[model samples]
Target: MENYFLGLEAVHPSCLAKIITGDKLPKKAIIWEFTNEIKPIDLYCYLQVKYGSPNGLQNFLRNDSSDNLIHWEWSLAGQFGIVSIQGHNFRTEVHLIGEHDGKGLTLEDFIQQIKADFKNHGKSMKSVRVELEKWTRFLNPYHRINSVVAKNIKSLNSLDVKVDEDRELVKFHEENLPKLEENWKYVRDKYDNAIGITFGLRSMLPVLAESFINLIIFVLAKPEIKKNERLLQNTIRQQIDIRVQSLHLNCIGFTRPIDYTDDVCKKFHTLMNERNDLLHGNVEVNKLKIGEVYFKGKVPVFVGYEDMWQSAMGISLSSVKYNTIFDDHAVVTNFIEFILDHLSKDLKEQVQYIMTNSELGYNPANGRLGSLFSDNIADFRVSVNEA
Candidate 1:
């Protein structure tokens, strides 16, 4: 029921002049925009150190991820505002907007609070940079700028009043963001480990793609076989292919595979072949389109690097394109989604079904299938839900 508003914009020349003169404080206005080179995850962690809990702020801080950047707003009574945080990798941007209620500390005060607490968290003032800027203004009325800012502030609010006002979502996000942060940190540290070595992302990409593909196959197949059977079975990949064919078929609720049509089937087979080559063979980079590299096989064909990267990152290829060689996580993710629309359908039916029904969740037994299934599902679910 508590509502908060925050708006932020990059600093412009006019805003800089105002900041230098102290002509406008964050308290005088309803919104403040801050930019810093510091990571958004670090900032949120900083806020938790300063503010005690993730719940103290909006859902933006709780759900912002590499794939799912978040923005939010709220308004009630005389108070109105919005706050947003968006991050990609380590880079971050923030915006806050609202009506100034006389009861609390000003936005400037909050920024200073962030700066002071940031220091305790091993961040410097320069790293936790904050600024104020007006990104928009009403052209017709000069005197009504304040009124314009405050007017219909409720419209900016994104409480999702239609669905328990995001309580379940808020709880889910609060519980998972830190875990996501930790997982990404692990990945980042692993990546950083390669810094001193001769290894490049190009070679790593294929390995990552192979891992992702095997992971998906393993998750789809784990429930049907026991640990020993999983390891002992020589036909694990064949079994997984059959199950995936079934799941993909069942996902569309079709007697025969529909979405996994002939074209998709061909693509899937090709993708599997490419994954196999990357895992087992020497890959050759295309001289012209390094991004579209391949392994020499029965036939030489270029892999869809853009499609795989976009699929892995859950984003589209940028308008600007270039030739770069790398196997991508997107290929695996996109393939999974391509089959099931989202991993949720596959997990709820395949993985969660086993967990809820079979001995997997009942007994706290450690196994390769169980561990991989649980970890990957949890991670994928969080990412999908956040998305």
Candidate 2:
């Protein structure tokens, strides 16, 4: 079993020395949860037992804060329990302590901080809470930035324009973007050095990046509805316009163009409402037995991968407003592959034109490219000519 220790930290060490941890209103505790089971010492000992290591449990009581550097001592663990600890700015602090020692940043300081808090609460300084599941699942809060960055990289890779065309979009958004990548190295270290568990780093980060870029495509393709941009705007009046445009079902453009045609638009209106129902909340599903009921078997099937994840966790996105920013990104990896497959054809030429010509403009969901990339857009690619 993996032993995980989550340390609570106040804003400053002076704040910690003054009072108790987790005792008052508005006292924010940033929990630093760490997991390890490799050493001879048990998890509980590392947490509750005091006096052996430099930052061992007892050292948090020292009235004087200054002391020689102890790798596993108060500096590392004592940061916690400071209810009013004040500082203008603070990074993870994981990087700032004892950085030169080859041991890497140890949890000793964090441990001492927690111990101090234990003392403040009038509780036994020799005890700590070590959770197995929460600590070891590998939910690295530290990785949040890097994961987002990886997504950005993938987003850039999926732009639907020729090399010269993509350069234009890059030139536009690159400068306007914010630098969200602060403390990106913590993520790098955890992925590189942490032990005892397998966490798939590439899973959601890549998907997030792709999904974001796809949403952008959908927004860009809004002006051109003939190709299925209507599938996205999917409102009643909008759907009808697309249907009429696609099938020329109604000569709305000419035949009595000015007259209100609710009759012609009814089917679209109903479907549009139904689509809203399905996308916005729980969808009722039932199975029918046709011809013969073979042995009366009963089983369950969850719809959509995201839906399944939600079901398992009792959390869902049905009511959440769809982010238009991510519309075309969902289909990018596939579309990029699609572009690769058609790189030698009329399609590729069209992409180059749409992407390169500032007048043409580029949309990830450009209907012309969507048809070719359809769904799976990542399988093919002979490096796009860079702008």
Per-residue lDDT tens digits for candidate 2, residues 117-147, read: 4445333332432322121121222134334
Q: Against the true structure, what is each candidate's TM-score?
A: 0.25, 0.17
Q: What is the lDDT of residue 280 in candidate 1?
A: 60
Candidate 1, superposed: residue stretches over 4 Å from native: 1-224, 227-232, 239-330, 342-346, 349-387
Model 2 segments more than 4 A misplaced: 1-71, 74-136, 140-160, 163-327, 330-387
Query: Model 1 over residues 1-387: C-alpha lDDT tens digits?
Result: 112321222233344335435633343333344446444545655544433333313343445432232332221112333333433232343333333445574555545545555655664333333221112211212112212222312222221122233223323365756665564454334323322111233233334333333434444544434345644244335443554555443232223343445454455555555545544654554411334455777665666544322432222112111121112324433554465443555464554343222122212244333311221122211111110
lDDT of each: 0.36, 0.31
User: How many residue pairs collide in each prediction?
Assistant: 15, 33
Instruction: Please give the lDDT score at residue 242 for candidate 2.
Output: 50
Candidate 1 local lDDT, residue 346: 41
